[model samples]
Target: MNVDGALAPAVESILRTARERTPGEDAERISVDARSFSDALADAEENGRVPLIAEVKPTSPTTNGERTDDPVELAETMVENGATALSVLTEPEHFGGSTENLRRIREAVDVPVLRKDFIVREEQLDAVAADLVLLIVRFVDDLEGLLSAAEERGFQVLVEVHDEEELREALDAGATIIGVNNRDLARLEVDLGTFESVAPVVPEDTTLVAESGITTTADVERMCDAGADALLVGSAIMDGDVGENTRRLVNA
Candidate 1:
């Protein structure tokens, strides 16, 4: 499967899987009340630290294997330890995630949940019951239309962008929450500086989130210093003691 220069083979493969995948019966309904990811972040910021959106990623193309912790239990621990929200990977084959994981985690925790997937169509939104949904700029054909579709589904869109052009597209699409992804999907390489470079160009009113390659307290502080309202972390939390790691990053 070929893709644009900005998309890596791994990401391209995930999109292919997403295209072929269909929503289950449960996806046809919305089961829970949607929490406000924006409100959660705003409330956390008042506490004097950058808010954390810890991820419930069982596995990834870059990781060795799936997490041993139960998804719901891990999500509860994250919320208990101070995660402002949770990001759940729902792409099954490469990421080892499922909508069931999102549903269970959403039911178990009070914080807003983010359905992180390679969303390329509106049908994907039907399967998501999260408060927030990730829309990577490079994956979707019409960013504005998709954003509207997501809004119609009662979700706050977290538009993920890898570069300045994508960032402009997101802003033009009227995205209120934007995530600066440091990992270049084309090569699957992470560089924390990506956020630092893009942060200056984002509007002050936009709720900015820094994603990927963040692993330490220093990294968290670096992003906060660069004007990130929230930080989305996965491998750092899942690879260590979930509670301790969540506390450590949340406190940072």
Candidate 2:
């Protein structure tokens, strides 16, 4: 339930902007039509490899020193390097990203795009305008309601968890796609062992995604061996040669 104090102010700004932009009529209008998460997984499986959800992150609260000013070029580079899906960080201030970046990236890429942010409320969902939505278990107080709202909006949800209890909560909320984040959000530390520790608890039917601290073929191989169906990589890809890194990680 704990989150970075800095993120609170950033989330407030995002919510305020979203409220100002959304009209009363549009706010009430519900669009239940969208692309399926199953389709994205199927495409990844058909390719005979785990789906790579490459991220276009400008900055991170944990890694405040590192930042990328250009999201459009980052998104284009990720797509060109054979990324099955694009994950764009839309939480500005803390992560230095915006929905504008996601919208722009979605417009530029043919692949499905995921809005990677700390999803707190239903109103925040409307602002993303992405095919997929990421909901962190630690941050969400109403897991079921968020999942239901995401489903109603026609956006696939990637329920993120760092521990057994959170993982169970995600499943109980009917999350078909689950991401085991290796990074400890509270302490801002990375532990590769988190995946191994939580692998046994993942249900057989759910598509598992390994998030954070993945940098090499060995890391991908390790996660794949532990039953990860896909990998959501960000800093590693963003900071290095994306094309070569993509070929190495995906082909590995």
lDDT of 2 by residue, 146-251 (tens): 8999888888889999889888889988998899989875455789899989989888988888999998888988988888888999887877677677766777
Q: In candidate 1, what are the lDDT values of residues 1-252, reduced to their tens digit? A: 124576677777888788888786566744435788778987887876459999999999988878968999999998889999999999989999998999899888888999998888777788858999999888788889989988887888899998898899899989989999999888899999999999999999999999999999999999999999899999999997999999999888
- Scored by TM-score, the top model is 1
Q: Whole-model Cα lDDT per candidate?
A: 0.88, 0.78
Clashing pairs in 1: 8-186
**Model 2, poorest ten-residue lDDT window?**
15-24
Q: Cα deviation of 242 in candidate 2 (Å)?
A: 2.1
